[model samples]
Target: MAKITKKEVEHVSRLARLELSDEEKETFTKQLNNILTYVEKLNELDTKDVEPTSHVLQIQNIFKEDEIRESLPRERALSNAPDRTDEFYRVPKIIE
Candidate 1:
């Protein structure tokens, strides 16, 4: 089993600005040791023939093709604007 020292746990807690009680520190020490042990076990796996991957499944972009297309005319684009000038939307002044 991997062993985690009380001092190491205390150091980590201090770095994270956590104030843990004695009982909590002991609990965390055991938990961290267990996590290390689990990782050590994983190191025993034979992955020489396995391929490393960022994700388990294949991923591909699902976006539509980026091609030029006809857009709405200016009159149609601004038809529903609550306020507008000749070529732009008009909004209330926000800054002095």
Candidate 2:
């Protein structure tokens, strides 16, 4: 990877919403350059047939089906509320 200049570091910091001091920018510039160098080394590897992995472990779909179950009785659902209308919990109006 090419060495990063101070100008590039400041531009990247602006893009990332970071407010860095001159010292911090200098420090991050060196750190980011080193990280890029490592990534560049990884790009040199031959992995033509290797599959890209999202994680180190092989993961399967872990979600349950979305079918609805019977809901709680209205009285049970409102048991813990401080305020309710005849059929629903009520709250202070938040929208105009």
Best by lDDT: 1
Taking the tens digit of each residue's C-alpha lDDT, what string does model 1 give over 3-59?
789899999999999999999999999999988877788778899999889887798
- Backbone clashes in model 1: 0
lDDT of 1 at 54: 84
Against the true structure, whose TM-score is highest?
Answer: 2
For candidate 2, lDDT tens digit of each residue in 7-96? Answer: 999998899998999999889889888887777887788999999888987788799789998889889989999999888889999899
TM-score of each: 0.43, 0.49
Model 2 CA deviation exceeding 4 Å by range: 65-96
All candidates: CA RMSD (Å): 11.7, 8.5
| Structure candidate 2, residue pairs in collision | none
What's the CA error at residue 54 for candidate 2, in Å?
A: 1.2
